[model samples]
Target: MLRRSAYKNLQQRASQLQLKRSASQSVASIYFPSEPTAPVLKTESIPGPKSVELNEELGKVFDNRAAYFVSDYKQSIGNYLSDADGNKLLDVYAQISSIALGYNNPELLKTAKSDEMASAIINRPALACFPSAEYGQVLKDGILAAAPKGMNKVWTALSGSCANETAYKAAFMYQAQKKRGSLDFTHEELSSVMENKAPGASDSAILSFEKGFHGRLFGSLSTTRSKAIHKLDIPAFPWPAAPFPKLKYPLDNHKHENHAEEDRCLGELEKIIKNHPTDIAALIVEPVQSEGGDNHATPYFFQGVRDICTKYEILMIVDEVQTGVGASGKFWAHEHWNLTTPPDMVTFSKKFQAAGFYFKNPDLQPAQPYRQFNTWCGDPSKALIARTIYQEIEKYDLVNKTQEVGDILYKSLDTLLSKYPTKMKNLRGENFGTFIAWDFTSVLERQEFLDTCRQYGVNIGGCGDSSVRLRPTLAFGEEHAKLFLGIVEEIFLKLYK
Candidate 1:
């Protein structure tokens, strides 16, 4: 009888222990775990032997000159990137600012393995011609759900360049349609377009800023003025490049001068619009000029552009390909501007995975079909991924978290950079989430700093000549920020000493 009583008591304790274990494993706990305690440097040098060998082999068939190292993505977890050489890096670049969540996110993996995902991937739908029945529901639940304020529609495309190009097409067509009110295309117009001439082929131009980088395609490349290499040898459109405001840093100190500078640029922009020979259909600008060295302008400056565009009846296209999807403390970076009138169109890609333009006006869609048609209009698989990303972001409240973490990172860098003014200057993107950057005195210094950072197991990236830009994932937290800061400070000290 005593043995039976003891057995019953043991069974009750085991059941209690099982219940405790189940309670501890909540859904949230399964998703975001603590990041690596510190970076692990397994290789003496980055792009170690294995990486070099793979790149050497890859170069035989493809251009691998720009590859930092071939990544072992399967081994990469969270904010860490694993290279072919088995080096795990604290990745701040986040696949050139494309990764919304950290690597191998559990939620994303679950989505990836779903039956819906399998269908989308294997039977990729040509969205415009023969869209799948489920396409609308997918977009509605995913992409459209995360639309910027006032944006009601999106036209999906393949990449950032393609998204911008499509927006340009929409702009050109809209202007043409407006001009040809209640009119049909003439035989001359039809024939001339076939020959790639004016009247049928657009003589209208898209205006971009001096340091703006749009894309590498023919039309988009014309608007991309960041680097000569991106534009060289390609015949460009007769587009005008306006001056972007070059504001002084520590903005409070030089408020008057910066304000005057913005005025000067705004004045020049209007002058260019009035004087340009071709009709200025639209003007494209970045909230933060990313590739053009992380150049930034004030909300006042962006607002001025909006006012000018409004006055001229020109469309304003905010290119948020690099800055969108919660990176800049907002779903869309342009939201920070709080424009009196919403932009005519906004182009996006990178972090969103699905590339496209968002607009409120139905007029942006062409009057007839085939005008904006393409094969496999967009990958539905990517849309599925985008959907998962957006849902996870909303569920986790990552945008606000990014803002909180970004503030800590910016302040930490501000303190660190103060000690090495010459080595790092123009620390920008304060309060702009994890999208921060600082200018090095020279290209060599910048490269050296990046190389040294990598040696210390942090994979950062550079932009627009001599600037180090941080593009950490939305998952990058206070712990990750502290780790990054400590590594950077160590590098800076070693370099200076």
Candidate 2:
């Protein structure tokens, strides 16, 4: 017998499925039954009338420059995001890759309306101190269920940067504690620490790779080397930096050169760790550099880095903030590495809806109370939502489904790329799920392409200087992929001709 989804796909071959269609149809069928059939452009520009009016009103109190257009969340469904301008566009970026289940999913709406959700929202707890009685169950059912392999302990935080910062804190403290042999803080050390000085304030640094984008907070920002603009006004830690390998495109075609480049970067990493003046307490890296134009390094490079960290007695932190929760077709992208031992800590946020670090080292926990403490350690409401997301992913086998759909989508995009060689180059993320991207010749062309996609009723995104990245939700399937490729092809056809 054919699989359930295969049957569903076969049934959908009839015609374009409506938003309020049967449940056995594509995800779009159930989630957005009333969703707009296609793009409806009523104005000359996207930020037409209603969007401009709303932005003008909001500008009085907030920064509205970055507002692309006022989105109509209620009208958005499945893979399509709606703007106040009444344009229903296929959304591949998915709210900067934070959206997991797609726009205003019916299941999420149901969860939001539940009594548990209501109480959690109205009576938000200071999780560390007064966690709800159902906290353990919520965790076990949600975030814990999808914890990185070999990690049993978790420390929750507020955001991606906060998660990375907390993990860095844990690493620094763990290293210092190991060096101290005891927690006996000297008066001078305490006094020095009060003024942000060494010994107590931490002489250790979080070693980060160039082109890795961790976050914009102080500690995480120090680790973020992707863009200078994000770091221009921020004060960053004086930390040791390592080179992340710049792999060539059509990865299989340039295997030898890519392997050599990885080795070169590995050598640089070792040199940074061994020769840097400050001690390397921990090294943080992304499994795939999502914001750095979706740059990828081979498993061999990661393995070598792991070995180096082990030798140096430094902790390894896998920043899965943008890569975790089935984005790369793995529960955790590091699973693809096949490491003998798990990394010291794995920091996560974005798709998980909750933010935290997963760690196995008990000693990594500070010996003293109030060390890892924060006012609101985490949000129980998000944890509840995360729990539901986890359940739905399992029920639908979304990750595996994403893998299959990604293969189809990647092949399709590769074909489109071939047709426009001058506009598209360095196509990447072949087997790495739908976490794909391609570089344009110039930043202006890249920006224009994104704007044009909006006109064609597709909401896409860009990263680095001149690269378009695909960060569609796990729910994004063959149908959505076909729509995306159609729009992309139309644009390329218009531009190239």
lDDT of 2 by residue, 282-381 (tens): 9999999988778888899999999999999999999999999998888899998999889999998998899999998799899988899887888888
Query: What lDDT does candidate 2 reach at residue 404?
Result: 76
Question: How well does model 2 score by local distance difference test?
Answer: 0.83
- What TM-score, over all chains together, does every model reach? 0.94, 0.94
Pairs of residues clashing in candidate 1: none
What C-alpha RMSD separates each model from the true structure?
9.2, 5.2
Badly placed stretches (over 4 Å) of model 1 are 1-35
| Backbone Cα, N, C clashes tallied per candidate | 0, 3
- Where model 2 places Cα greater than 4 Å from the true spot, the runs are 1-25
Give the TM-score comparing model 1 with the true structure, all chains together. 0.94
**Candidate 1 lDDT, tens digit per residue, 141-259?**
99899888888899999999999999999999999999999899989899999999978998999999999999999889999999998888889888999999888888778899999
Best by lDDT: 1
